[model samples]
Target chain A: MPKETVSLRQAACTFVMFLFGSSVIMGVNSEAGQDSWISLLLAMLMALPIILIYARIMRLYPEMDLFEIVEKVIGKIGGKIVTILMIWYALHLCALVIRDFSEFIKVTVLTETPQLNIMLILILVVVYMSKSGIETMGKWSVIILPVITLVVIFTMILGLERIDPTNLLPIMGHSLGTIAGGAYKIFAFPFAETVVFLCLAGSLRKKDSPYKLFTVATLIATVIFLLVIMRNLLLLGPAVTNAKYYPSYTAVRIINVGDFLVRIEGSTALNFILAGVIKTTVCLVAASKGITRLFGLCNYKHIVFPLGLLAVALGTLLYENIKEAFDFLEIYQIYAIPFQIIIPVFIWILAEIKVRQDKAANGSHSPDSAQTDAAG
Target chain B: MNKKGKCFIIVLLMLFLLCGCQGYRGLDEMVIVTGIAIDKTPENDNYRLTFEIVDLTVPVKEMGLKGQVIESEGKTLFDAVRNAKKRITKKLYFGQAQIIIVSQEIARNEDVGIIIDWFLRDVECRETMCFIISQEETAREMFEIEALTHPLVSTEINNILELDQEVTSTTLCVELYKAFGGLHSEGEELALPVIHKAINNGKTVGETNGMAVFKDNKLVGFLPPNESKYYLFAIDEVKGGILTLSAFGEEHNISLEIFENKTGASFDYKDGKVKVTVKTDTTVYLGEVMRPYAPMDEKEINELEDIAKSELKKNISNSIKKVQSEFGADIYGFGNMIYKKDIKLWKQLAENWEEHFRTLEVEVESEIEIANTASLK
Candidate 1:
């Protein structure tokens, strides 16, 4: 089969959708009260350097995914150890997002539907998308991103009348410590979670600049996050925004224009499901690649079904109820650190050192000299 | 079979699974509730809920739809709501409910936060529904009164409250979300419209007049309809209302219809005391003149404007004083204004804000412009 590659625009769109996956429904960290927007802005600033490092790692290993790069950079045995960890991270992240989406659907729209049913239906779609390969997923992202963006912009415009600007007053009322803590939560969950893109970066065309893709996508997602946070805060006020489980849905429920444009939250629910599909599919594909590389399988697509089923099972058994699902979010921020921060940063440093050494050795030899880089 | 044919069959099967047949309910299987009224049972502390369900049996050819009231009792609001299943054959769907009426007894005695928890937490209940406190003996009585304008008393009350924006600004329309916000916020209080039975043209009807003010989650006092308008003026919510002035004499009154109004409340803190200055700018058109003649010179119009401004200033000040001395609730968001102005001062005054509000000095200033006399003048 021909190698699958996605254009730079499709990659960026996928990145944006992935960032919006669970964050849109869960909303930003409300511990900062009315200052949640400030927390989001701070999170964006902190995420910039880390995402740049991710882009740098992908650029160093031009056509190799994270799992392949790990084996090459570190010896095979150590690389296998890291690969297992990455596989767990990818699979767990996939299950977490699936659980978030299913819980939202159960709590909001389909109250009587069992969560297992929701997860099964969602995982089936995700597995199909994963089996279709990265090119198809990219194209799907390109088509769905605009619909999600339009829904968000439309809701914001209609919600303007209900928003009370005064709700944003008393800015920075919370202590700096509290605001920083909120910003850290925002950074760990949504922003740093974009590190999953490295697993699929190998599918980008040779001409596509990973740096530009990650930067532009992160910036766009940050702006959307700010608008959504401010909209929720203004529409529901700080107190209600903090108290509700899903602030965005509750905020959009209040948008009644001339009483004719009511119940537009259905559109919001659709956006959540669509974005969630892209997110879960990315995680499933990444995990499938990890498993194939670990076990020496001929193709990753062979295991996408079994892996997706595993994710569905994990998602179903992860939480007891909606409250437990939300309570897991706090632990998730801390739990995500090793996969999102440490391992990526470590791999990026090793790749940079190896690249500079390879350049030095090549510079010392003639143009016709034999290539000694076994990883290449 | 070819791959394409097999793939098509699989896709068709998946489509059937995705329809979510488990939670599906046909429209005919459920009865839509337009409004709900909650009152305490006469015998015990259990909740008695009255649901005004839309009567689906009414033919579309009829001018207006009819409503059927279903009453249930239980230990809690949700229990009472679920107990309603014993009375009605179809399931009670609350997604379209437009209003929730709480008896004055419930608002005065119970912690409103507890009463509304089910409405806010329940996924089926909408947060946009308007909340009104029924001044009648029981909230269910408000639903039993005659529905003159609409077949359902709930619909009638919802229409009257909506029309209040254009006709009379005497009543406050507080949605469930807004009440929740007020209950949770430290610097603000909740105020909802008061509904009661009234005689209109020899027929009984529900009327929304005045507002029920709450200190925290419990109702503390009531503002009369006339004073409610002034309360709206103080809070800058007076969209359209009549301002009558007897400048010529007690018998000859001039009524000015408000066209546009803007009220700005500023705070001045000195020596630990907070002073609020409410400035109102209004434009009005001469609506009616009870005098014998309709003609009025420019000088007379200017004098009339001055009289209207002073009267407005006096009424607004009086209403603020009434709320301050009687309820001591910061329904006007004076505390919120200070909090927004200076966080440090607000933090210091946050505790015991109601006590501070009771003694807070307020000054009222008004500027009125008589745009033009009506076609009569």
Candidate 2:
């Protein structure tokens, strides 16, 4: 089979949508209360260097996914251990997204529907999409991205009447330590979680630098996070915003424009569907890639179905109830730190050492000698 | 199609079968509950819940609309609501319910937090449901009153509240989540509109009596229309209302129509004590004048403004006093204001806030601007 590639535009769209995956529903760092936007600002700045590390790692090893790059940088035995961990993280992250979305639907729209059914249907779609490879997933994201954007923009515009700007006052309401802690949580879940993209960076068509995609996507997502957090805060006020589990849903539910446009909260449901599907699909694709490489399989598509089923099963067994799922979110920030940040940075350092050592060994490094070094 | 297409189609079919069409409710199979009224049972501790269900069988062109009121009793609110399924043929859907009326007994005896817990947790229930305390002797009797305009009592009450947004607004429409917010808030209190059946020209009609104040989760006191208006003013929520003032030595009455109202609160911390200053800016247009009305000079207009300002201050303070001294409930959200402005000061004052609030000094300032007199001028 020929190498499949996605356009840079599609990659950027997929990245932005993935950032919005669960942030749109759970809200961004609401623990900071009225100071959530401050936490978000700090989260974006903190996430920049890590996301840049991901791009740099990809640029260093073109056409090689994290699995391949790790094997080259680290020995085979060490790389296999890291590959297993990456695969497990990918599978676990995919199930968590599935559970997040299915729990939302269970509580909000479909009360009596079995949670397993929701997870199954979602995983089915994700399996089919992942099987189609990265190009199809990227193109699908590009197509649905605008629709989701318009839905969000229109909901924000319609909600303009109910926003009480006083809700945002008394900024920096929490202690600096608390606000920074909230920033760490935000950085881990949505921002640092982009480490899964390292497995995807190698799939983009060879062209411009991947930095443009990461930086531009992060900026767009940060703006969206700010808009959503501020809108929920202003519309619901701090008291209600903290009381309700899903503040954004409740805020949109209160939008009564001449009684005609009531219940526009279903737009939020649409947003969760688009982003959640894309996020889960990317995770599944990455996990399948790791599994295929681990087993020396010929094609990654063969494992997408089984791994997708495994994700659905894990989602059902993840938590007993919605409260437990939320408790997991509170702990997930710390739980994901090592996988999302520590391992990637470690590999990047090793790769950097290897690149410099190669240049040193060459002794007359230039563009021509670099080509020879690559062939060697 | 190839094997992959066939397998994809099979999986789609299985998916639909798995979902079981859970949310598919046909119009005919579902009953739309527009309003609910709850009252304490005469003998037991159970609650008698009445539901105002819309009858969809009626045609659109017919002037006469049909609705049914069903009553049931259970130990809990959810039990009572679900018990309706025994008598009714279709499922009772509350997504359209706009009003929830609780009897004075329930408001005083039952915990509203527990009563509304079911509504808040139900997926079909909306967060915009209005909480109303029935002033009628029997709450079910209030739901039985035929609406003069709309087909259902709830729709009529909803309309009345909407229209009340304009002239002399007496009651505040408190949504379910806002009520929940107040109930869950640290030092904030909750207030809901009171409704009752009134006999007008021998016809039973529903109207807003005043407002009910809640301390924590239980009903504590009631405020009349005048005081409720002032409470809304203090909270800076008055949209449009008429303010009547006396001028020309009480001989002539001038009514000002409120157009814009802004309320701001500032905290003054001095010597381990807190003082909340409430400043209100009101923009009004002259609406009515008694007989023997004449163009007034700048001095008289200033005098009228002063009278309006003093009147606003007195009524607002009186409302606060009644809620503070009598009920010891901080329904004006002064504590919330303090918390927003200065958290450290609020934390120091958080304990025994009710006592502090009762004795705390509150300065009410009103700036009234009269835009112009209407066409009568």
* Clash number for each model: 0, 0
Index of the highest-TM-score prediction: 1
lDDT of 1 by residue, A88-153 (tens): 999999999999999999889888888888899889889989999999999999999999988888
For candidate 1, give the lDDT: 0.88
Chain A TM per candidate, in order of listing:
0.95, 0.96
TM-score of chain B of 2: 0.93
For model 2, residues B1-377, the per-residue Cα lDDT tens digits are: 99999999998997767655666787878989999999878899788899998877777468577778999889888899889999988889998999898898888876889888888877788988888899877788887786898888888897787567566678888888878877875678888999888888899999887789988788988998888998888888899999988877775388989999998878798997778889999998878877576775677767878888998888888888778889999988888888777777778889989888998888999999987777755
Residue-pair clashes, model 2: 0
Residue-by-residue lDDT tens digits, candidate 2, A323-365: 9987787799889988998999999999888776767887775
Judged by lDDT against the true structure, how good is candidate 2?
0.85
Per-residue lDDT of candidate 1, residues B76-180 (tens digit): 888898899998787899998989999999999988999889999997889988899999889999888898778888888988997796678898788898888
TM accuracy, model 1 = 0.97
